[model samples]
Structure formats: C-alpha cells, structure tokens
Target: MAATTIRTGSGPLTPALAQQIAGDTSHIVGFNILITDAHGTVIGSGDTSRVGSFHEASLEVIRTRLSATHSAAQARALEGVKPGVTLPILLNGQAVGTVGITGSPAQVTRFGLMVERQTEILLHQASLLRSTLQRERELEDLVRSILAFDPLVTGHSTLLDQANDQGVDLTASRVAVVVHTPGRTPVPSTTSEWLPRALVLLRESFQHRQTIAVSISANRYVVFAHPTPDGMDGILSQARHCVEQFRTHLGSDVEIGIGTEGAGPTQMRTAYEDAADALHLGRRITRRSVTTIDEVRMEQLLSGIGLRARQRYTAAVAEPLMAAGDWNTVRSTVIAWCESGFSLVGAARRLHIHRNTLIHRLERIEHLQGWTTRTAVAYLALYLACKTNEFDAAEPSDS
Candidate 1:
C-alpha cells in the first residue's frame, strides 16, 4: 500500500518517507498502515492501492494534534478510511503527518501510538541528518573560500564575516595537513559516501584539538589544525600521531602531508599548498605515507623549476647516460646514494647490491660518461637532476 504524500501546502513529510513508514511499520505490526501528510492525503500505505486517498480522520488529527479512533460501525462514516486508530506524527510538538492502522479501534490504538512514535523518531533523525549534512557543506564551502582567498582582493571582509558567523577564528595559528587516497579501492569512491567514513574514523584523533577539516575534492581531505604551544617540533609530533590514527583506521594506503604553521588567510593558503606539495613529493619520491614540508624542502625547491627546464637540465647533465639508456639507473642510484649520505655501504645496502657492484657501476658511469660524483658540483648537479626527474614525472603533462 502507498504511504501518504505531502503536496503543495502539505507538510515537510515527503512521499518517499511516508511510503517507507507505512511499509515498514505494517510489516512489523502485521497490520495495514496508512501514512498521511498534513493535508490528510494518503501518500503511503501498506496497501499500495489506497495512496492519494483523503482520510478525514487524519485531517482532524492534524488539526487537533491528537489521536482519533473509530469502532467498526463508526468506520463506515469516515471517507477513505476503515475502523482504526490514527495518531498525529509530531515533530517538535507539531503534527507533520499521521500514522493510521486499519483494525478495530481497541485492537489498533496501541499499535497506532507505537507507529506514531516510530514515525516521529524517524522524522527527527532525518531532520538531524539534514542539518548535519548542511553544516558540513557550509563548512566545506568556507574552507574552499579561505583557501582561494587573496589579500589583494575585496572579498576578505565578507569572508571574515562568514568565518566569524561560523565561530572560526581566522587569526588563529594553524598548520594545514592534506590527506589523500591516491588509488582507493575496496572502499567507496563517491565523495559524499567516502568523506563521512573517514571523518568518523578520525573524529577521535581530532576530539581534543581545534581542527577545521574538509574534503576539498575527491580523495583530498584537508585539516587546518591549531598548532600546539610547543612549536614546530610539537606540531610535527602531533601530525605523526594523527597520521597513525588515520592509517590505523584507513589502512596503509593513506598518505598525509603536513604544512608549516601560521595565522591569517595568506599564510594558511600557503600552508595548504605546502602540505599538498609535501604530499605530492612524498608519494612520488619517498613513497612515504606521512611527509612534512620541512622534510622535503629541497625537493620542493627543486620542483619550483619548470618541468621543461628541469628535463633539459637532466638531459644536459647526463647526456651520455640518456643516450645509452643508463640515466634511469644512474638517477635511481644517485637518489639512493644522496639519500644515504653518499656512504658506499649504505647506498649498496639500499640498492640490495654488493659494494663491488656499486663501485663497478660508478666506474662504468665515469668511463663512459666522464661524469663522476667525486666533486661537490658534479654530485650536487647529479643529485638535483635525479630529484628533478622524480618531481617532473609526477607533474601532469601539459600536452
């Protein structure tokens, strides 16, 4: 049966929910149920055929905010209704809809009241869910605006007003952290479905602190956290804990990048970019799940050079290696060596090769390319080229 529907000037009750109430309540109570909006029209009913009928008893209940019942004999007098009990569905003490059961008044009155209470609870829960979603949307919009804000623009005052209304203090010092799931599978991909799950998982981690978290886009979540009084060291420590919290719930696939701390809009925006860059570098180069801007500053600086120029530099520095298809290995070797502090033993261990093999490879590079990592200039250039290639490959192709 169809449940009661809300039409123009009907009620906040939607036809879909009314039908759900009618179908579910009837199944549970083993009786036919009819749901009516404020206008007394059945939008949903356990008996699908009765939908769109008017129940005069329901109209009276809506008007009086009370329950009405009828004996089997009295049921004949009411239009579009049988001998039953109808109770107003109250939300905040106002009737929004009615739930009616079809049976003798004495037999159905208790079940009618039970259905009424159930419908009211459902309506209230729906209202709360709507409110929470709306607030989340508003908060996301606020974060988007703040991230896009430019001090030279005229909208700063308006943005400040909005932030003030939301009880967000823009002047407070905050460090931006960007969390992303690069290739999420076996999990929801839809932003609306995915965001809440992640947020709920991280809610406990954020409960003690002031954090403004939002999903800026698909798979990209940002959290502007208030830095603790202990400064950079303390903030990073907190960020590590936060990363562990995320990974514990979300799994090892999650990656997080942390930014520097500062107050106001411009710095906050910069911090967001910093965190994003850190995440990019961490994911592409180190394959690390948690990365801080401070840890990747050199790579970040190297990334500032245009991809084309960096490509040219890499080509120029290792021209012979490129021609012989040895640059890829050299690049890997250089990055690993540099990262291992140019220690032959550590570099060999990192590459899972013997020291003699490493020495022979270096000898082959010098003999064929005449490029040795013996001097500071040569080592630095080679190191930068390797780093540049990592970032360059990560960059999206302009063509």
Candidate 2:
C-alpha cells in the first residue's frame, strides 16, 4: 500500500490485530517496530521498551510525506545495522504518522515491506479508535470540571455539601465569590483551557491567607474560600483586584461579575445565583467592564408579601430596634440562637463566648433592642431577618 494511503486510513488497531501483525513479521531477527504521530510522539510500539520513546523517523515521514527505504549502513543511528523501510501512514492523502521495522538489510527489506503493509492497516485503525477515546475522555473531564463549580452551571453546591459532610467547621465567616465573563462567548472548543488557568491564579492569590477551591464550567468559575483570618471585605477586595489583573491578559471582550460573600459551600449556591443575578444587572445598568453582586440591589426578601404589609410589619416591630444601630448584633444573636438549635451552649460556642458572656450579650441586645427571645414574634422576625438580611443592603457602587 502507498504510505500516504496507510496514513489516511487512521483507525485504532486492535490488540489482536497488532499481535497478528507482529507475529507475521517476526521472521526478521530482532525486528523492532514503532508507531508515532505526526508530531513524533510515540503512540504505540511492538517493543514495550520503546512505548514511550520518541520516534525520530516521524519527522522524516512528516517532511517527506512518502515511503522511505534506508540501509542501516548509511544511517548514523543505524550504522552497521540492517536495512529497513519506514512507511508513513497516510490518511486522506496526508501523512498522519509512521511505522517501521529494523533487521537484516536484504531480508529486512522484503520482510519490512510486508510488515509495513500490515502495520499501516493496524496503526490506521488504532489511530481512529485512540482519537475517539481521547475525545470521549476530554468530554467527560469537561463535564466533571464544570459540575464541580458552585454556580448552577458548575453545581458548586454539591462540592460544598461534601465539605460539610466531612465535618469541616463551616460558618458564616467563610466566604466565596462567583466571577463570570459577561457578554463574551465561552471558549468554543474546550471548557478546560481557561477555567483551570483562572483557578490556578485564584489559588496562588489566596494561598497564604485562605484555601480557595475553584470550579469551572461552560461559562463561569466559582471560587470557594476556606475560613480566613482576614476580614471578609478585605479578602474579597484583594481577590477582586487579582481577577481584574488577570482579566487584562484575557481576550478583550471578556467581562466579569463578582458575587457577594458566602460563609460555606451550601450557602455558596445562593451566593452564586445572586452573583449571576448581579451580572445580569451589570449588563443592564452599568457600562463598567466588571460588576459585583453587591452592586446590585438584592431582590426583596419579603417581596412575596404585599408592600404595605411588609412596610407596616417592619415599622411596627423592627423599625425602632433597627433605628438604635443594634440591628446587626440582635440579628446575629438570633441567627446564632436558631442555628444552634436554641442550645445556649452551642450558641455561645458560635458566638465565641462563654455561656455567661453569651447571656450577657443576649440580655444587653434584648434590653437595648426591645427584642426579647421569649417573645415569639420577636423570635420569628429575627429568624426571618437572619435568613434574609445578608443580601438586603442597598446596592453598592463602584467597588
């Protein structure tokens, strides 16, 4: 067969066929055969020792794109050796790769041609199968990498859920940010290319202060943070700055949206959704190249309730306490209480205080805020506020 023809009919060579070809051509003494890609990468070989060795002959095949016969006497690397023919496997009238045999010059010439013919067919089949399998693996990795991300596109919640299951000390102090490239088409051919690089960059930036977990999907990347000694705002600001710097090297059309703080992975899903929402808002309201979740007014926590009723409820019950500037402390206390299952000890632990100290803080908040833990209405409002207030502040502006 013409070398070009063999190269063109690329297909995965079955082991059975490979063994058969090897057996048929074993008559030549110590004949070694190697198969490689156009780039000279060894893909397969008859000798196990050469499995990873570079196929130097691939360059000759790639350049000439034709069959070549050489005597070991004439070749420096094969000096005082046999003669063999290195046949290029051609597919679609092009040199895709090569296969060859080495042994006695006269006997090698005849046997090499026959072996070359068989190896050509085998390697062609092998190449096709290898290509298909590679493509499948790439697809699977893409899906996994994408799903590992916290955003809906990435399912970051799933990963965080795992962290929680492992009994990682999860708390509101831990935070994450979801950054998206707005209005830019995602990398069309592969999802892994830029996502991994972005994640590596994020990890490097967060290395000393906190653990950063990254997830990448078709369109976005979510960064999950382990508890950090630094303040959330400061860590977030530094992360954002890093992302901005990274953006400068990306394709010009790239845009990014940053999510608000989230304590752990479970809550990260909500944060991711919020960030996506903010990105939507960014596309609509701002002309800036990057947007942040905090920059968007969060959806009304009580939007489900009638506006008049919500206003009346807040005014009558929450307004006076909130006006005293003790709203956050009270709200945090209530959340701690509820989250602790009303266990004074647990709540105290969460508050990082001794039980007596916890009681003192609770009593002071109750007295100053007029929010008694004994009152069911007070408790309920506090719960709702805790559940909802994390994102209720007025939209932030420019950082």
What are the runs in model 2 whose C-alpha is more than 4 Å off? Answer: 1-173, 183-216, 226-229, 251-256, 260-265, 285-399
TM-scores of all predicted structures: 0.75, 0.36
Over 255-308, each residue of candidate 2 has an lDDT whose tens digit, in order, gives 455565665444555665665665555665564545666665534234345546
Give the C-alpha lDDT of model 1.
0.78
Per-residue error at 398 for model 2, in Å?
25
State the number of backbone clashes in model 2: 21
For candidate 1, write residues 36-101 as lDDT tens digits.
888888888999888888887888889899888888777778788798898998888888878999
lDDT of candidate 2 vs native?
0.56
